[model samples]
Target: MNPLLCGLAANPALPPELVDRLLTLALEEARADPASQFADDLLHGLADRADLRHDQILELAAHSDTMARYLAYGGTLDAADVDPGSMPNAAVALLDERRGNLAWARFLATHPDPQIRWKLASCPGLPQDAVDLLAADPDEEVVKELALWTDSPVTARLALHPDPEVRIAAAANPSTPLEAVIVLAADPELTLKWTLSERTDLPQALYARLAADPHAGVRATYASNPGIGQELIRVLAADPELQVRRAVAKHPRIPLDLLAELVVGDRAGWNLLPRIAAATPAELKEPAGSRHAAVRMLVAQRRDLPPHLREALAVDPDASVVRAVAPHPGLSEELLRAMVARHGVQVLAAVAANPDASGPLLEYLTQHRPGVRRVLKEVAEHPHATGPALLACLADRTSRPLAAAHPALPPEAITELLADEDHQVAEAAAGNPSLPRAVMLELMP
Candidate 1:
């Protein structure tokens, strides 16, 4: 019943000593009960071990359990030893289970069952020769599975496949040559053109072609590519479609000056300020002082703001701006305390969550706001939480789970929390690294 042995047996790769230990345990279990599943699983693990002799593999395969026998035949048995006549179904199942085994793939290549051939087509790590054979499969579904193999030479053949769906998959594959991509871009189907527009590696010439595409959807897709040149970006910026312009505004490489203009001039672009705020910190100074509270609210959340900007936003007339700034670590102590006094409990909870809160400030919040349990949970999890603050959190049933997992919680309290009836409390206690080794052995499955 050792979980480590079961885990080791399930893994295909194992260190020599661990494999020896697993085999020893399996043999001991098999002595007591000859048909133990763990012994069979361990035998299967040994069958996959490259260090074992061919005869040892044969012995394990001969006595393996039904499931292990099937895997062994597919994985380790030579083609001559397999009786194709006696076990037709097992032969097919073996092929399905075999991964990257070239001999098995060759044997199954001509399997009359298209379904069996389909399995070979989808199996990963198969030899390139085997993949090339599967690509010409008469069944479209089997051919479709070949599309998933990006490195295979067959992917080039799949690009020219008559089936548009298969062609689309080939276009999306990273291995598809740039020449094939150009052909797909010119496909009469708008969907194929749109899919090609999303590829980041497309050359600048393709971007220009896609930018002027008659379909707005294709142009919009090109607008989102960060690699699109500035000239193409400006053209897309003036695109009549609001969606296309919005995509232009969000491009990471969009000129900062242009982004600032879009924020003020385009109504659709205003909603994208959060994204713009991340790239253009210096350009946002004017937007931070915007008369519109929504624009100011998004700017207040930017961590790159100077201390002076944080202080200014902290005292803004909008409560939302104050709430957004409350959790910022750089906010002045005077501003945090003033906001806590003027605003409601939610603002106090935010301040409590800020790791930079001084020990004196945490103490004041813990004592003065005894009834606010939400703030207590934040204080309990804060890295700066003191012993007294954590104790206050542990006393409340509503906040005890967060407190139980806090690294600052005393070792003795954690031991007590391990026995807590609440599943969440016990689960949190189990995850704490400081939990004694003996306790972890009992709690971890």
Candidate 2:
């Protein structure tokens, strides 16, 4: 490379092509002596030349280190060089350089293509004056982009737009002014009215009003949003549309009482409610003894079941409910045993953790069943549960824990068993670990 050519390559104002070839030569030789620029200057010149195909120009631009290219650009790129398709890419580069100048941006704002115009309007660098002009643009596409605006007046104008699509777009915009969304709730079009149902963007006042909207869809749309009022949820739970009803059934906001309505009686006779009812917590249940096996089945899984619910469900005719109630945490030990006679020891596991289980049941658990004993042992050692019911079992002499239980209990029951003394009592305590450690140690020798 000639010394003059080399020096010219370093010149910031040199024609882009010669600078590019010189940069390539410098990079090819690994000339770190202020010469190995990531891209030759000519490629940037090619990128700026508008007559070249965009892809070809991009191909050249892609070679330059992005940071280095912006450094090379040094605030000289005019609006003419900003291509419509490539406008975002170049604008991003310019913004990154903090070169959000009027000339570079003005070219983009007034670009012939709406795509470019929209992108520029959406850009954070778009001047407030430019945003005001673009927000009022008549094109729906331009109007829609204006909703991205954070300014209340600018976002509101588009939000108040007469077009349903534009209003829908505005309602969906995160920056849409709250006042603007309120205006749409008053729109007559079903779509705009329906847009009021969405809980995500609409204000609380607007969302509540929409829930009462006379249009079924508008009210139904409100039902779909979890933020809809609880009273409104009750109303929507009865919505005629199966789609709306189904949506309510799945919404966490829908009232439990309303869920019962939705979960019962087949509007279509097949009964979608049965599947839904099968998952309710026992605390939500109203039936002392629910008829549906699935509903009764769900009642068994609730940890918060009230005593009335537990007592009522304890005698359920369904063996599954009996089995479920047998191990219910809320059920008394005596109640658990009664349920067991109905559903058998297989059902006893349900109440194994019940703090109210009788010592006799614990004694029975230690004898023949490994699974039941394992559960009883966990109840004894589990951090959250106090195993007072296991006192008699832990005090017994011959008690033996089921082998290979998870969260194994410590060696301490023998002392509690020694204190127990009764033959049946001692045997039951041997398997239970909640027995007094000192009593077990004294009995060890």
Question: Model 2 reaches what TM-score against the true structure?
Answer: 0.37
Q: Encode model 2's per-residue lDDT on 1-445: one tens digit a residue.
A: 1322322333333344443454455444443443543334333333443343444444444443452344325544433445423444466455435564554565555667676567556555456676766766666687676665434456666766777777777776656667766666666773555544443755566666666667665565667586666766666677777766766666655555566566556333222233233445543555435556545555555555677776877877777666655655656666777766666656655655566665456556545343454455544543333234344234332222221111133335333333343443343343233444343233321
lDDT of 1 by residue, 1-445 (tens): 2333343343333345555655666666766788876666556555666665565554554453343345444466554444443433344455455522356666666668787777667665666666777777788787776675446767778888988888887887767787887788778872665666556788888889768888887788889787688888899988988778877877877775566555554444143343555645566777678876656766776666787777888898877677777787777677788887887675778788776888677767777653587788788788887767887887778778777767667777776776787766765664454555454444323
Count clashing pairs, candidate 1: 0
lDDT of 1 at 379: 84
Worst lDDT 10-window in candidate 1: 1-10
Q: Report how far off residue 160 is in candidate 1 (Å).
A: 1.4
Q: What is residue 17's positional error in candidate 1, in angstroms?
A: 18
TM-score of each: 0.55, 0.37
TM-score of 1: 0.55
